[model samples]
Target: MKKHFLPLILSFLLFACGNPKETNNEKLTIVTTTSMIADVAKNIGKDSVSVTALMGPGVDPHLYKATQGDLSRLQGADIILYNGLHLEGKMGEVFEKLARIKTVVPVSKGVDPTFLLSDPVFTGSIDPHIWFDVSIWSATIKEVLAIMIETDPDNEAFYEKNAIAYAQELTDLHEWVTNEIASIPYNQRILITAHDAFSYFGRAYGIEVRGLQGISTLSEFGLKDRVDLVNFIVEKQIKAVFVETSVSEKNIKAIIEGCQQKGHNVVIGGRLYSDAMGAEGTAEGTYIGMVKANVNIIVNALK
Candidate 1:
């Protein structure tokens, strides 16, 4: 009995000592609601934290239903970040609950209220998809920096430095988008897509945007939408319409066909990464790359 007890005590001591240094080095575990927010967090957090995106490429945040794994990640996170304003639809409740337990931040909260879009569908509520405009996103990034600093005050200097660098990049990107979009003729710069996800983009770049559906993917396109867009395309003599990566192109295809039936020649501008970034490892996979790819596609197609 004494020999057996001695072995048990030694085993307990080994277990207590095992990997103590490795456990202490574990980085802050951060969970984000969407890939876009996850991308921005990574840029600012750099190597200071471990970030995970609940949604992947082409996943629609509006219709996303959180899985058990997502809840577990959120529950374990040191900080949870999401684009608020009901972008996650029903899943926003989950984040609300998590906020009670941990540091949950709506990165878009700091965006100027005036810059937000108000639509009848939402009873004049602001649009949740504010990341489409780089300038607006710059404000969101600041909110993110504040959350990061709050979570790890010891790393305040690092987060501040990274946020400044990232903000500069965003400023450059905004200027580049403005210059590139300016190259397109105003009359020829109409942006038609499967949905009205680009309202902020159009507003920012001075382009007219029409959509087959409303802001939310849950909404369906009606005959009125089709007729109005077809007429607009014919009236404007627009050359092409765009489809989104996450949304079905069926509606846009119908629009293209309707325009052709009316003898109005139009083609698909190319697929735009609206709700998601490009496939991993591609140039358009990152947030900055995604915005640049979109600008390049729009400028090339419209110009």
Candidate 2:
């Protein structure tokens, strides 16, 4: 009887120590759909929350499928965040279902619906790439702060203070980006990439932007796209075309070959972080870092 009692006590202790339920004071466990959202949530949450981004650097969110581990993480998290506006494509359905059970918030849901681009494929649908503009992202950050406060009322003040500080940083970033881009002559500031992810960026920064692929990666690049872009580059004497970190460079390479065939010289400006950020520990790993890297690349390439 004594031996049996001792074993029961050991089991209880192990369960208590190893499987302790997360407390309010303990870090809030947050699962996000993309690295960019994870970065912004980190800034607002600071040390108060532990963030796990399902999509890492160079991952296309539209094509990303949730793994079993990701589902498990989402199931257990105190809060789940996604870009929404269908950025996750098929994954958006999963988040919608999870919303019924837990606090699943779309960080970009607060953006003015008018700011979203209308796409032909989805007819009446808006583009999900709102983070391309810093002003639009300021609104998204506010929503993140509100969600954090709602999840952990005890940390409301802390989250608010951090958010204000971070928002100021974003404000400064926007001004800096505006000034930097203004230095480049308008004609030299065209941005051509693998997809139409930068319409917001171009709209805000005063640049002409084009992409080989449509807003969704589900669409394939066709001959018309190739011919149009190649001819545009040749006719305009466009200096550089950029490639996205997550997308294949094959299409951009073909564009280069086409330009060369026309006796026009074009250079690959640099890789840009579109749907995702750089790897952890790199300058472009965080949201701010990703924007800064893009601004630097665009300024240097165009100037």
Candidate 3:
């Protein structure tokens, strides 16, 4: 028990080392760990909540560490939201500290265990990339909506109204993705990427997915893993393998080179939004836009 709780102990010790910041009382300040979570919070909260994402576009949450500045922001926020299932592995201790004093919540808390994917490499942890499956992700909105209402009961009706609209958007996006991915030839539906971040996506869209690495970017890939994936691609004659915005491209590049060595020309389909979304002002920044962008790239290259 002591060994298991060590990270939380370290986090508490480090909290006193960071400088404090002034708290804003104008609106509900929600600090999220990833761009997708921030986008969802923004959609549900609308202009009533101010959100800050600790991890930016193309940032990998699995390897991200909390800086003193990040600590300050988390400490100052009225509500903290993160996609829990060990996605923010390094920052788990920090969140444990905040949970004691603030309204710290995991967006995945609302998802059913039956719908979650278990990590094959890890003993008990589940996959954290719920945003890929719009249907599973829609369940998270209820968690966010409930928090928003509880924190500010005066605007309960307003928050409820926005939650309904956001839920509908997710439903429509799920339908769009299902229909769009169906156009790909049954055999050509294999999706290869740097890591196993798209299992939910594959399950939802009926695509056969493979990754060189494990579910989390923290898991490293070996030569045997690379060679096996390359062999699979050569055997299957897969046209394109995708690069994730949040994961390193070196491994994917190596896979491409390996395929070339085997006399198979596998091109990079396109960059997919995996762990993180696109820039704030862009279409891909939003959850719906991110899914559509990935589907467009996958279908165009594979078809």
TM-score of each: 0.90, 0.90, 0.91
Instruction: Give the per-residue lDDT digits (tens) of candidate 1, residues 152-242.
Output: 7666666666666677687778778888998998788889888888988988878888888888888776788799999999998999899
Clashing pairs in model 1, backbone N/Cα/C closer than 3 A? none
Candidate 1, number of clashes:
0
For model 1, give the 10-residue run with minimal summed lDDT.
12-21
Clashes of each: 0, 0, 0
The candidate, 1 or 3, that scores higher on TM-score is 3
Report every candidate's CA lDDT.
Answer: 0.81, 0.82, 0.85
* Best-first order by lDDT: 3, 2, 1
**Deviation of model 3 at 145, angstroms:** 0.5
Question: Would you list the rank order by TM-score, best first?
Answer: 3, 2, 1
Candidate 3 overall Cα lDDT vs. reference? 0.85
Runs with alpha carbons beyond 4 Å of true place in candidate 2: 1-24
In candidate 3 the C-alpha lDDT for residue 106 amounts to 95
Worst 10 residues of 2 by lDDT: 12-21
Q: Which TM-score value belongs to model 3?
A: 0.91
